[model samples]
Target: MSEFSELRYLCGSLVAVLLASILLTRGWRSKHRHLPGPPPKFLVGNLKDLPTGGHEWDQYAKMSELYGSDVLYMTALGTGLLVINSFEAAHDLLDKRGSVYSDRPRLVMIKELMKWDWNLILMSYGKNFTTYRRVVQQEFQPSTVAELYRPIMATEVIALLDRLLRSPEDLIQHFRLMAGAIIMMVTYGHKVDSVDDKYVALAEAVREYSAQRPGTELVDVFPILKYLPSWFPGAGFQKYAAIGKKLSIQMRSAPFKMIKDRLASGTASPSLASRLLHQSVDTGGIDQDQFAQNTCAVVYSAGADTTLAAMINFILAMTLYPEVQERAQRELDDVVGRDRLPNFSDKGRLPYVSNVVKETLRWKAVAPLGVPHATVSDDVYRDGYVPKGTTVIANISAMLHDPSVYSDPDTFSPDRFSPTDQKSEGEPDPARAAFGFGRRICPGRFFAEDSLWLAVASLLHVFAITNPDGRGGNGVKGIRWSSGLVSLPSPFPYKLEPRFSKAPELVSAAERT
Candidate 1:
């Protein structure tokens, strides 16, 4: 045989061998696929079932209703997906077997260029993650968080009230400013003076880039797309990375510089970043890149947006159910009084108000699918095999609205969380699941909860938020939601009138405090 023909024959044999190896691996996996799931199409798998844009979770809800809790499948790109649609299932996997299910799936765009592998929200479960989590835990200890941040939170809440009083029509911007100011103060020890401040602008820019879009980056689904060169036009991943780099620099360097300047001048306020920087200088255990990048990523992405989304939902809930709002306001009035704005100290006394916050989180979890978790080892769940490296999603939306756990899961009733209601019944309160379960749960949860509680209590006490009468006006009548990974109440017209006639006196009192 000619040399060319011999080479062709050899290539064909190698290709066939590679194909056989792949088939053998898949066949092995198929044997243990005991979980009931829709049959996958050849090559595409169950990609067709995955929804895009705002409808993703909505579609997942419908599927859960049809297929039951444990829905397992292989995506078009050969990625294993397990969507846990029940609280019990999520608890069993994310909490009970956290060791094998705590890591995040490989995010090519975030991992490669952005160097986000060490971010607490994205990092895999390991010693490095443990170290970072430890630092965060120390920074956000309940006592320290309340003590160090109560004054700042109070100031921001007052400012939010002021903004609302001046222009009661712009509730969306008011909510954004309130959330952004608190997060900014917590992260940088600097207050956001106005919604248009430089820091607010930066936060909004970061949110815009991180907002998920339909088929935004093919790389998220097709891992091989990361292999494409940056020069390739129409490669959305490259643009995303570039945007992330710009955001990373602005987010990291700006705060680090602030800390450095403050330390040089010996005028730094006590903050998580300041403390971490000081500790880094002494121990030299944490890498500078990891420290800066991870800190900024936390504050910028997870800190601001998640808190803002929750706050927005709280406002939306109040607007939808005015009776709930009135009860919360009455609770605040009895405990906090109009003489002073609500503070963290009033938390225990204001149980009903706290219940409202919990209900808001459950009603619309900020990130419906609580950040996709990756399997670190092969997981055996009720005779079904979840192969190592499979992408597992804790469908937080479904879990929050689980019919078995929560009665009338679709309703927006805060009574389910009232202390007496749970004690009266022999059942555990539903608010326990709102913060999430297990190792990967949000670390800033305490901070977020406090911010929302103070803001909600203060807002309810000071102003009456109502759906704007649009009979002859342009105000939004029926509220709608915006589409994104973080589902926030879409911008709607709402009137924010002072509850009492003595508005000026209330403003004066707030200013005095």
Candidate 2:
């Protein structure tokens, strides 16, 4: 009997071991195992492999090359990260199959801690997002921009030219002010007179303090940290979060409240907020007035930052590549003439200038790694399994800089886009990748592009951007770019002078009218 009991116990132990082995194998399986990427380690799972320091976009690009695939997969702990390197791959997943990939990864730092849930750039995909996009799209559609926003852009560009002539040394500040001015007027009809404009200051302060590592904060990974008290160990971010919350509320509400009060008094100027407020009737139980405020606030914050970054890039490219600047100026002079600053009507006539704007966008992407998009459900792409909740990052910088797509991509050459150029025949337009992909493509892109063109054309038509030492064609060497969601050139020494004797007078003339 004892021998029989021992045999039974042995059989039971064998079955238990087999069951455990099967479960362990299943648990260890990765849905993205078919995708190429750095080998993940046990437990840590590629934590050390994540890019660090600035120009992470470059690092990811290199990783894509090393992995020998456009879709590069990685993981931290148990979370998956999908980096799309090529335009084809990004377009395929983020654009063509947008419904499955349009959702955004939850950002605990920005949404919960900073209280910026209303920000359209980071808002998740859902009914609220749809409502916000509808409200914003109506304001920034091409027709609306042409009818209402173009004059605003032309006016601001002229003001920028005047500001550059007077305070050329404060180049970055001037760009910031110009961007703020355009956005303020377009969104709330708020006139920004100077760098000290209260609305600009409030919005800027919130952006600066609340900026986080593109959704990679520790609190973002482990949202439970948001519960920690400000005084607790490693809870310093909580205090800043508190400050950000207050500033965010004021920034989102102050200008909107002013517009609302003006409308009530029958004095509200025609602005996006005011117009939306006038037409705002309750939509599906959501507050229309609040919706208007949210959409306008989003436009103000997002539009200003991207516009300023692009302008800065155009300046950097001109300073570094004087030949490109000269060609653009020649185009402007030939098409728009020197008597008046360039306007929207000259856009089609000045293709080279348009290409210069395109090249600037390609050379240095604004939002290099676009705001992260999240997978709403498990799906397969290119024979690879993409698990739900994966953080999908469309590497815009990588797509724009792919040498296969743009030969000698690192060199700032606007001619690469010219159909007449011998080297290439009208390479793919960078705007497709520069702005973003699919459902999340910038709704305000029409106005944004118009704003960039007007600024670039006017600046080139008026000023000769060169090295600070006044040496023509001598470029700022060893240029470094800031690393974040938005990339811009680090402050470099530059000089702005009237391209011709009549340039300053033309700018003054335009500003006066």
Candidate 3:
């Protein structure tokens, strides 16, 4: 038989075996069987109910609404999946009971097949994970970001503005280069001027492959499939996994080796990698070199894609809300003035610009479903209970878009956050749910926000971004949102026009300094 035919035969045989085994074990029961969710099928469980297209976060939110509970439970192929769809439930569970929910699910595709075990974000909760968090947190705290990384952030924004002005059509590429540049510089003291840079390509490739999750892939739900030989019928995942493993290793080791070589020659530029390497110590049964390498790789991969996605969403929002853009520009012109670009010193004075940044994060969360958290022990909440090892997901997009939390939640209104005479408290900050919750929150959040603030402020100050096809200020009609670990608007045509007569001069001057 042909390879394709053989593959089909193998898949059919596997399913038959699975069905027979399931029938034999039908006597088994689930402790979470009473939890709120759609009923499972005889063999597929909730497999057919899982989202195949569109945003998973949105589907999960609808499920939460249909069940009339913020916490949801479902099973696919006998694996338990728990989704926390509201901020309150997420806080009550993932935050208040973090000791039980901080661990990550055994992402078979991400860890076993792709060999991304070094990823601190997906690593199980333990001493190694704690140390990795501490290492990254030390470098990205607000004070440290302000004191040390603001210059790098500002420099990148200026470069981005220059690129946007020259080739406005490649808006997404410019954002990618800008985000990659800032991350490469901060994490490894390496410079990236183009999206085609080898390091940038490597990071992007790894991010794309790593998007696979447990429920999405049969191999992830049944990890024993990982042992299948690459030449085996229906084992294409094994071959794909090999590519991911190669990229993962290169992503972690290449730039790190350069830094180490430079350090040996006493020529290493000060960077997170070099700094951590200098302070490397074998402690808690962890190898310091491996620890630093893993930390730096995770920082680079995580920071680059997320910032790029957020920037794209910011541009999409501007294209769809010209009035909001105009208002932000007015604030920028009034505060920072058109004579020059924005700087960290003016951040406090630019309240409206700050709110615009906050609205961008809330309007479209980059990671719609924040990294999945796993339960290490059985947990009870309200009338339901989550068994140990349940793959817990916080629907971050739902929380940020909760209508009760923010009136007219779909509207992109920066003023929602501004305190008024009648409502002095204003709306709750989306940052609480935007960055994440509990111990698994993004450590680089402060740095990410700082970079985003400068980029948004500078872009608004220099250019008028609008849709080229005259879809200005219209709702997202032609635009489609991508669904993945990080979600953002797909590429759409947008025009960039200089707001000030001296826009080019301003970008040039900023670059010179």
Candidate 4:
């Protein structure tokens, strides 16, 4: 054959192969056309580029801006992902279409290690989820929660004040102790008197388990890795998994065992675990041993760290904005009085104090990205396709900081939530973003709000929180926030001086009562 003819033939053959490959790939793409998302590169999809740890929300926000609010697509490992960044989008999916969007994304390690198949937060939206949620709702029902927890909360607030008076220099530990005590009391009917309580150790273990090296869960992204034997070289998943299992068992079993012992001895205080144990058989609600154990684990895990993180943020907000603190204190003084502590009934009269609580939640949401939700059925959102089983995230951080919604979104301005500060008739409620949206919203929200408000009001009532003076004559400074799934104020130097001589007397009286 002529050289020109041979070249032509070879080129034609190459073109034919390329055409065949394109046709095959096109067919595959057509099958996934219902899902909208950024174009994926070969093999990696978007998982390789997924941001890790605390700042992932920032990256997700940027992607939302680029791809529009209801963007959807697949991850590298063939897991589906849907990012909902706008309030409207989140409302539409997580609320209007909640049936499909209420399920949780699968976490193989968390599931296997913690055995949380039926935990309210981790379980999919089904009979199990419904049952668990109903039980949680009952336990945290407004009347029940207030009745059982108000005294405990009041006592803990007093304890917090006492600690602040004794070591005003250690605000971080005081906040931690107060938060731990309240949650411990609610969860196990036990009070955490000191930071060194065994409950605190259990909490620390959970924190360590959560803060373990980021890439430790290869199985999370690549499910096939889970099938590999633990004996493989560099398989740290097994080690971490073991630790997680041990920690979860300790955390879970301890609370239930306490309840069981109390039930046996007839000394049990009213607790969720106790209620569940007694009701589970009759209701056929959650009778499995592991299921009941997982229920306690869920409440403890959810209750401890996130609640404490919010309380820390509350203190940080007060410290940073003394003016806001002063205003709240004034409102509390007027409504609640110095002789008495704040209570649920005082909520309406203390609108400014309420605003402070709302703004603190808005200023820095404890769960900024909220929790991941998995779609249970194929759906469309804003002309974008959200396939069944897609991992959906409501980027709450973005919604709270949306400039169009909140003027100067970065500023800590509680006044933004003040009813008098409303510029128009149709302004959004600032508290709307704090707890979460729709059915999956934090069930502990009412309890969380009351605890935060009481703490803030009581703290402000007695203390003149200020930045500690520096050696060079500058103020000690505001907190430097730490990065993680939960954003916490890095331990910073601060001075909490008593605002009045009667503060100590007030704390003592409240404790004695």
Candidate 5:
């Protein structure tokens, strides 16, 4: 035979052998073939089954309903993804199996190329994550947040009330500004004078960039592709990541540098950074390192943006159900008189207002599909095989909107949680599921809850939020729920008026100092 013909024959044999090996391996590993889920396309798996638009979480809830299982398993381009659509399943896997399930899946775009891997929110479960979490949670845990940060948070919200009173048209911006400024003060002891302030602007840019990211990019599904040069075809995500990396570094370094300077000069106000950085005399004068700095930056992305979203949802809820608003305000007024704004001390007496906060989360959680958790080893439950590397999600929206759990899942009724309100036997309360379940739950949950409660209770006490167009009475909801990781009530026109004639003087007299 000619040499050319012999070479062709050899190449064909190698290709056939490679194909057979792949087929054999997959057939041998098809233990989950019996697990029910959406039918995947040939070889492509469930790539086409992925949600396409802003309501990805909504689509996931629907998938769970159609499939009749809280845990729905699927694949995309060979990647295993389990769409968890129940609180019980979420708690079982992410909580009960915390030791084996707390690790985060590697999202190349956000964590690697974007350089956000340093943030504690996306850190892997290990010694590094454990140490960083310990530092960040010291100030934000339930006890410290109320004792050390409430006064500053209240002052920031009062400034928000002042802004809303002056420019009622800018309600959404006012909400964002309030959330950002509160975190800024608590993290860096920096006061944001205006929404346009430089640091605030950087944080705003970073927030916007983070929100625009896709749930999962192609590079994430195929990690090898991340190594491709930016000039390569379909490498646009890399360039996008470069832009994010720049913003992230600037966001962390700028404020950290300022704090260090002020601390050295003895001009810095009390802050998490100041306290965490104070040369741990016990540890022989330790210095604040990159770990702490990145965690502090996480305050803006994970903490500020999420609380802002919840507060925005609260306003939308009040606009849709004016009666709910009236009930919350009545409770606030009864417990804390109009002589001053609601304070941390008053939270204990304001049961209805607290219930309102819980209802807002249940109505439409800020991030409907809480952050994804990954499995560290292959496991089986209920005769189902869950392989390692599966992206496990906690479908909080499903838990919140389940008819069996909530009396009227779609309706905004804070009374569902009121102590005095009678609930049917066996009804499930979804309050704990709101923050998340288990080991990877949000560490800043305490601060977010308190910040949201203070904003909602204080605003309801002073202002009656309603739809100015009067369409709410016709049962037309005005606001759209967000589809992003950090979901906020989409911008909608609403009227904010003083609940009482004395609101202006009350707001002005309240402390902003």
Candidate 6:
């Protein structure tokens, strides 16, 4: 038979075997089997619902509505997957019982083929995880970030404005570089001198390739399929995995070597890597050095991301709501004056800009379904049995867009979060839902917030962003929110007009030491 036919034959045989096995064991199923979810295929269970190209967060959000909030249950190859759809459920399972629910679900592709099982975010709840979290907390504490990182963020914003003036069409690329440059300096003490720098390329590639998750890949569902020979049918995934493994190695090692060489030559700059090295002890293995390298790698992958999407959305929001943009400019013009750009010192005074940031995060949560977690042992919530080894997901999007929490949740009204606006009925600040819950909360949140605020305040002070094309915003007519780990708006045409006649000169002056 042809390879395609052969692959189909093998798949059919596997399904037959699975269905038979399921029938044989049907009578003695566990108590949790009664939990609610979409009816699974007789044998494959919810595997049919797996989204391949990494937009499955939307599917999970829809499943939440069907399953009726709280805890949800599904089975794949007899392994339980519980999706938490409500705030109470997420806080209860992921926060209260964090000891067991804090662990990440095993991703066979990332763990085996990509060699990223060592990722701090993916590692199980253990001493190493604790060390990573503690170190990140030490480095990114609010006081430390506010004290040290402000100038760095300001300089990058000035540099970004310089780029925005010269090539306004490439504003998106400038945003990416601004974020990447800040991260490179802070994480490794390495200055990114150009937009096409080697480290930038590597980090972007890693993020794109790593988007594939557990349910999205067929290999994750059928563990036995991994053992199948290379010559067997449908073996393309194995080849892809091999390529990913090599890329991951390069991604981790290149910047690490740059930092190590600088340290050896007595030329290292002050940064998280240099600081950690000074504090590291000889742990008698690859671990001590590995710890620094792994932490830097994670920061590199995540640093530019969460805010990149939101900053773009912030610009989009201005185009849609010109009146809001003018109000923010008036705030900036009043506090910062025309002599200098808005600095971090002016943040508290710029409440409107802060509200814009919060709304962007709430409007399109960077991660609709927060990182998948796993249960290490059996537990029960609301009389629902959460079996051991079950994969868990928190439906963050449902909460963010819930009508009850956010009246007119579909509308983009920044006043909803502004305390001074009397029209704004009191609602829980969406900022609570933006970062995350429990142990998995993003460590770089303070740093990211500072960076975003500075960017917004600075940008508002100098520029007027408007969309001549009216379809990009409103009550969500033409707005297209992505379903990736970060839910960013798709590209939309917008104007980048300077508010000041000397915009370029101001940018140049700010860029100078």
Q: What tens-digit string does per-residue lDDT give for candidate 1 at 397-511? A: 7777777677787677878864454466523454455556688777777777777788877878888877664322332244455555466666654567888776547766878
RMSD of 1: 5.8
Local error of candidate 6 at residue 226 (angstroms): 2.4
Global lDDT of each candidate: 0.70, 0.83, 0.84, 0.70, 0.78, 0.77
- CA error at residue 113 for candidate 3, angstroms: 2.1
In candidate 3, which residue pairs get closer than 3 Å at backbone N, Cα or C atoms, i.e. clash?
A: none
Best by TM-score: 3
TM-score per model over all chains: 0.88, 0.92, 0.94, 0.87, 0.91, 0.91
Q: What digit string (tens of lDDT, one per residue) describes model 3 on residues 1-513?
A: 876688667667777787677667753345344578887776777878876677888898888899888888887666678888889988999889999999998878778778888888888999888887877777899888988899889888999999888988888888888888898888888888887788778888777666653235667756667788998877788888898899899988888888888889888778988887777554467787888888889987788889988888888888888898999998888888878898989989999889999999999899999988999998787877777888888999999999888889888899999888867978888899998889999998999999999999999999988887775645776666777677778667678899879989999998898
Better of 5 and 6 by TM-score: 6
lDDT of 2 at 48: 96
**lDDT (tens digit, per residue) of candidate 5 on 1-513:** 664465346445644564455456774236465356787766556778888766677798888888988788887655678888777777787889898888888888888888888887788888777777776766678789878888888898899888888887888889888988998899999999789988889988887787686566656755666787887655677789899899999999999999999999999999888877774612222244675587688888788778877887788778778888887777877888878888888878987788788888888788888888888888786678888888887878888887767777888876676444365433455557888777777888888888888888888988989888674654434456667567666567689888898888888998533
Clashes of each: 1, 0, 0, 1, 0, 0
| Residue-by-residue lDDT tens digits, candidate 4, 183-206 | 777776776889888867777777
Q: Alpha-carbon error at 290 in model 4, in Å?
A: 4.7
Q: What lDDT does candidate 3 reach at residue 398?
A: 95
In terms of lDDT, which candidate is strongest?
3
Kindly provide the TM-score of model 1 when superposed on the true structure, using C-alpha atoms.
0.88
lDDT of 6 at 364: 69
Measured with C-alpha atoms, the lDDT of residue 129 in candidate 1 is: 79
Candidate 1 residue 378 C-alpha distance from true site, Å: 0.3
